[model samples]
Target: MNVMKRIAQSALKKTLIVAMATGAMFSTQAFAAEKVYRLKLAETWGANFPIFGDATKNMAKMANEMSNGRLEIRIDSANKHKAPLGVFDMVKSGQYDMGHSGSYYWKGKVPNTLYFTSMPFGMLPAEQYAWFYYGGGMDLMNQVYSPHNLLSFPGGNTEFQMGGWFQKEINSVDDLKGLKMRIPGFAGEIMAELGAKPTNIAPGELYTALERRTIDALEWVGPSLDLRMGFHKIAPYYYTGWHEPGSELQFLVNKQVWEKLPADLQEILRISMKTAAYDMYIQAVHESGKNWASIKTEYPNVKVKDFPPEVMDALRAANDKLLKEHASQDPLAKEIQASQAAYLKEVRAWTDISTKAYLDNEAK
Candidate 1:
């Protein structure tokens, strides 16, 4: 009976040990399931930049949902947490985990970065999206950012933009001289070359600057955003198709932070950006059409004019010269331009046959 009691006692001890181990395992799994991370995201534009705000909020929302609340992002607009132009470096240095801004904002740091934003007389929004996603443009962009300890993904895009809102008419190249213009990136440089003083100002400050006559001209996104900002009220002479042909925005992540993310999460970010990029482009195109109509009806005094053919020709020539000068100064600039030109050749062929043909017929 004692021996039987001893065996029973031993069995009971073994059972307790197993139960304890199982409990410990369950506790660890539960702890891991509750793990949470918070990331800081920044953008150059204010909350009013529709695509920037919308895409960013969408990304944060999707990430939270997918992660089951394990990951949360806190977004801060320009000067909310950092300066607008400082975003790229902040993300690169891990001061901020992520940023959403125009690639052109960092032209001083990376001259080739402007290609990701827009190239003068370059591809439109749809074509830019195709080039970046499918034509290996993103890979080339990564190459440019790699040295800076950054990883960039294409974010929202602003489709074809208006030439600008000018206080005075630009009938010829000579008219651009000595004009204090608020522009950015290669466009700004081209303006300076053409004798305009190109100044960089945040979107939020644009309206007041134009109102106070601090700037002679301003080029914001398009009619929709411009109308909302009341640019037409100040500069009634609106020109089309000169400065920014197509503008693309970007999502930049710190290389270290990006590398640390789970493979699946990294892919989720890329896919989300890719989807948002195209969606935002379409949204802008649709909104611009509606906004143009609204502008004509609401603001009868605003003069809407197509850029004269001579003006367009001169600007195009200046753009080409500016690009050549940039390529000469920066090897990366040359590389990006080469890639873009090559990809555009292929894209133009197909687009000319299909999309352009359809548009031309519709115009007639």
Candidate 2:
């Protein structure tokens, strides 16, 4: 009996030792694998620039929390970076691991970037989102950015951008002639075609430019943001949106930095950006409603005018002509235009029946 007991005890001790050794190996592996990644983002907007800046901040916060301290993102706004329009180049060169800006701002650098933002008479917010995620927009966007060593994602959406708070009303095609406006991207080209001198002024300088008569008219955003800028105080002739029906901002990532992230952290970052983007869209709608109400009551003297049919006709003609001319010059530009046009045609049909029909019914 004593001999049998001794042998059993010896065997149990050996089993325990093996188990302990195996657990130690796994613990060491885990210790080695667990890594914290820190990333820096540069944004085009000034610090705490409301809806736009909020998106970046929210994205960073969510990424940190969701990754359980594995991922840390630090954001530097235009004020800190001192380069509002340099986001694309910075991210592409790895100076910034990430960037928050509008894709359209990079049109001169990459023509395909123009199509990803709101085009003239383009799809609305929901429609454009569908086109991006479902209708090959993301793939097309990637096609445009990958060669540049950057990855672009839809950062946020400001539903409908107003035309401009013109110092004077637009009544005819001739009115656009010799008009100096602060516009950018495809719309700038269309305006140029119609004889308007369109230039891009940074947001911080827009008010001073307009006030000093450097720019005759300018479109910043809609009531959601325009109120804060005090555009109505000087340029009260607010025009309705014909350009940038649904303006979408962008997030850019350095390809090398992206590849450095673990699969889980990458997913967390992706989800964080998308959620914050959606939140910005909703907040824009909310702010517009509230501020628009205030505008109607408090700013009764401010004139909210739509461009006359003749001016609209001229714009559409110029838009069509410029698009054809520009698209013909670049194969990629042609492809992007074709995709947006096709997606708009398909999505607008459903939109007419659902949203448009509902709104039409409600307006009565």
Stretches of candidate 1 exceeding 4 Å from the true structure? 1-34
Candidate 2 residues lying further than 4 Å off, grouped into runs, are: 1-29
- Superposed on all Cα atoms, the candidates' RMSDs to the truth, in angstroms, are 8.4, 8.3
Candidate 1 residues 1-364, lDDT tens each?
A: 2456557656755765687777743344433434466788988878656766887888887776666555778899885864887898789889999998888888887778878888777887778878887988989898989999988888877888888899998888888899999999888888888889999898889999999999999898887577888888789798886666678889998888877666767776667667776777777888898999998798889898887787778778888998888889878778889989988888889989999999999999
TM-score for all predictions?
A: 0.90, 0.92
lDDT of 2 by residue, 1-364 (tens): 2456547656755665676778733343343234679899999999889899999999999998776666789999988999999999999999999999999999888877888889998899999999999999999999999999999999999879989889888888888899999998889999999999999987888989999889899988898999998998888698999998989999999999999787888999999999998999999999999999999999999898988888889889989998899889999888888998999999899999999999999999
Which candidate leads the pack in lDDT?
2
Q: Residue 319: error of model 1 in Å?
A: 1.3
**What overall lDDT, based on C-alpha atoms, would model 2 receive against the true structure?**
0.89
